[model samples]
Target chain A: MPSSCDEKIPRIEHHQNNSDVSITICGYWSLNSRERLRLLRRWESLVLQWKDVLRFEIKCDESLVWDSSLVVFLRNANRDLSVNGGQVVFLDLPAGLNKLLNLADEGQKRNKEQKQDPPSDGFLSMEALLKPLDFLGALVISFLNLVRGRSVMRWRDFFASARNCSASALPIVTLISFLTGVTMAFVGSVQLEKFNATIYVADLVSLAMVREMGALMVAIIMAGRTGAAFAAELGNMNLNEEIDSLETFGICSVSFLVLPRTLALFVMTPLLTIYADIVGILGGLLVGTLVMGFSALHYLEQTQSALTDMWEVYSGVSKSLFFGLIIGFVGCYKGVFSGRDSASLGKSVTSAVVISVTLIIIADAFFETAFSLLELR
Target chain B: MNVSGRDDIVIRVESLDLAYGNHLVLKNISFEVRRGDCLVVMGGSGCGKSTLLKSMVGLLAPLRGKIIIDRDELWLNGDKKRKETLKKLGVLFQNGALWSSMTVFENVAMPLEIFTDLGVKEVENLVDYKLALVGLAGAGNFYPSELSGGMRKRAGLARAMAMDPEILFLDEPSAGLDPITSKRLDDLINELKESLGISFVVVTHELASIFDIADDSIFLDSESKEILAHGNPKDLLKENTLTKVRSFLERKTVNNS
Candidate 1:
């Protein structure tokens, strides 16, 4: 199909001597895409007519400038010929081309051997489904060891994780908390002003920040930031066999790696939530004074009066503790059990963030429902 | 200095000095690897043998020196020319750093796909041939985690050979293999060298592998931070020129026996 140019077109001459046949490939075999497609089509048709040929001999033109494309085409042709009880023989071929043909033949033979024994199918069985329960049991034992001061938890790693989870996360936490408080105040003031009840906007912002949004927003951010970091760090260690090395030294990897990370998160998340609550209140104070035209002192007084019962703030801070545990445990579990490869490590990090955020939301819902029921009682 | 007439001189490293930060690793090192020659770089555990190999393969730049491959100065060339020169060379890293994400077939096909305009079917056939060369023909579909350590090395070797490079660099090919597997790998290297006329730069501490495959060798001393000796392994053993080299080789021999 290629237009004949300066490059020579390959020609096949067939000669029959008794029951033997010889096919001579003449001219340049430097076939590109178009030429190769045409050549294969022609060869396929020619192979059907040469059924009587018992032995096939191939001879190439000496001045041929060919690539691997030629070799592959010939190999495919030979495969078709061999299936029909004909054997192809190379005559006067260059040493490199001959070696390539031999290598292809060897590969074909090995492929046949592999076909006899199929590879294992990577599927989770019933036993694999229950493996998480075993992981959980080991985690509980590690926690008990920590309680008794017998765990192999590294103080350095724990403090490093704590600093990363708390101080390093301050910027994003402050931004999200301030923005959430401002938006809530603005929306509530608009609705309240219609009823000449704009002064109650402070009460609305205080209740929302202390009871729900502050803790929930902080938890979601930590799940994305800290949870993904935990998964990636542990996944890298798992890929490098560092976990195995620790186990080889008689150290429990769960205690040494997971406990420190989880404890750091558990201790830090509530502190971060409380910080976010203060920042959120300040943001609401700004919106109340500047936008809603309320006095700063009046807004603060209204907020204090609405939060007379400390149960609202306590419930929100308590929810953060549970959210922190869920994020840390899920992240470490995904990381420690990650597959021993880079791709699986990436997948583990992704799943860790997703699962932690989802679990945090579910926990938040349960707490919100429980607190409302308690208020009614 | 007139290496132009000597077509056999494939690689020439002149007055090479390598450093990581201010700590010098190898100093004033010079070596030449000829065509069809297997140059084994030998040293103790912390010696700069692997670092020197990395410099030669363009993974690291020497602190001060020139590396000429086929008369083209590797470091002096621009990006395009450097890539052109690198296309003629293949490297197998320590621990067989195959992409764990891809299957073995895709790993071998990667170089061909990037460098050549060959179609998919042609690439598949070439990958098959390369895998077969390294005795991994049946492992095309298997991921790196699915294969044993030796198989991973072989798969890495197949990927390195996908381009049919003129110079092949292997770092610790026999590091994590059984005796029979190591021997088989050695045999494959020898066969490829003889059949394809490829010059090999192998970095290793295995005496058995060195004796079996090295046509020439250089010994780097950790204390001196320089090449202690250079010659054929057998001749170096017989000459006993450097006490450190002799002791290292003798210690390995004793361990083997």
Candidate 2:
């Protein structure tokens, strides 16, 4: 019995002889991508009809000129038939086409074998839980080696990183810090204006800038800029096998790549934080004099009085040092351990920024609570 | 510059000089690739083999030379004409250079999409054909990261061949591959050359691959910063050529024996 399907180019003719089923593929059989999708959908329905047939034979017309689309269609059909306890055989194909089909089959088998053994879930695996501890252990060992002057921490790398972390970062830090201060002053003035306490807006802005906002904003900015740069650079080096080459040369990659970057950030961050605090106070002064209708002398006097206690400025600067360490460590960690591919490099850069920002916030919260308990607030 | 009778010459380099920021890499290099010829570029590491291939493919600018392709001066022409000339060529980078963000199908379809006005369906069909030709028939949906080294190289080759270019340039195709996979790649190159009449410029130091596929060959010496020898690999192995070339080929043979 012959049944003709609606597919014009790759028309499938189904025939049944007792318990045996034979499907003949006739016509051009060559289809573009959209047509291939439609053909696959049609073939899926046809396979459902042949579920009860134990034996299946597929024949391709000699006029057929096809490509991988045909292979995909056949592979899907074969898989469907096998699942339903049917055996399918291909016939009348060119030798090259047959070889291609066999190669595809081998690839599919290898993929299946790989898929059969899935990786353990991150939350469920003990190894995953210990990964952070392992990273910390390595960091400590590398740090100790550096302290002993036995590490391959080059002064040139440190100076270069210092320039990258400080000089290259100044413009963005200034812009962010200034804007943050302006926002704080504007928002605080609106509330203070109702009580005719707009003059106190200077106090609010100065206190926040010197205690939290300046360092926090700078840390977040660096996490996005410098931290991501580190990850991308190191991840690319890792992909190029430069890190492996370093190992072959008896050089410690961690000490050579990480220590300099972290130390540079550690030294530059607090200096930048102090600069950001001054820039932020100046921005608050701008809003007080121009937007809030306060005299410049009065705003400056209020800011000076509010920031008379140097402990607030010191706290923010100290927090930035830790934030810098977190950014550098996370960036270098993600990069050095990155998988050997461009996709992994992109992923490492994204996670470095994300993890650094998150850890900065957490560390800031701890600092805030500790300062509050000690009455430094 | 006469194009009256030399219809078979696909590419000609005259006194090519290449440099990177004042450091001369290859100098006074000249060669010609005839239609359907498989020309192997052999050299030791840092010997400017890749640099010469890059210049030939228009990825780099030679310091001074005339690179004539399909009877058109490659470097002398403006951007539009240069692009038109480049359309007739395909270069597969050493590391496969498959875009990590896209699947194998998308990577192969990129050239067809950019260069041709084919509808999406037609592009898909042609991409499938190219992938099948490179023996990656069912690996279309897989990303480059998921593929093994040999599979990635095949995918790269499929992408390079997507436009059905007349001249194909492969940089170290068999590097980092096992002997069996290398042989298979060599066989595929020869098959494509014979079937499609595509001229190939392959840069490789693998002696086995050079003997298996090269119809003609050129040797670039790093220390001398020039082409030391140019001829058929089998003939060069027997003939009294440059000492470097003789030792380079014989050392591999000696190691194998």
lDDT of 2 at A284: 89
**What fraction of correct interface contacts does each candidate retain?**
0.00, 0.00
> Which tens-of-lDDT digit does each residue in A16-62 have in candidate 2?
88778988776545556465567667878877777788899988876
lDDT of each: 0.83, 0.83
Off by over 4 Å in 1: A1-6, A15-21, A31-33, A48-55, A111-129, A373-377, B1-257
- B-chain TM-score for every candidate: 0.95, 0.94
The TM-score that candidate 2 achieves is: 0.55
**Per-prediction TM-score to the true structure, in the order listed:** 0.58, 0.55
DockQ numbers for every candidate?
A: 0.02, 0.02
Give candidate 1's error at residue A52 in angstroms: 5.9
Which ten-residue region of model 2 chain A has the weakest summed lDDT?
A112-121
Model 1: per-residue Cα lDDT over A343-371, one tens digit each: 99999999999989999999988888877
In the predicted model 2, the residue pairs found to clash are: none
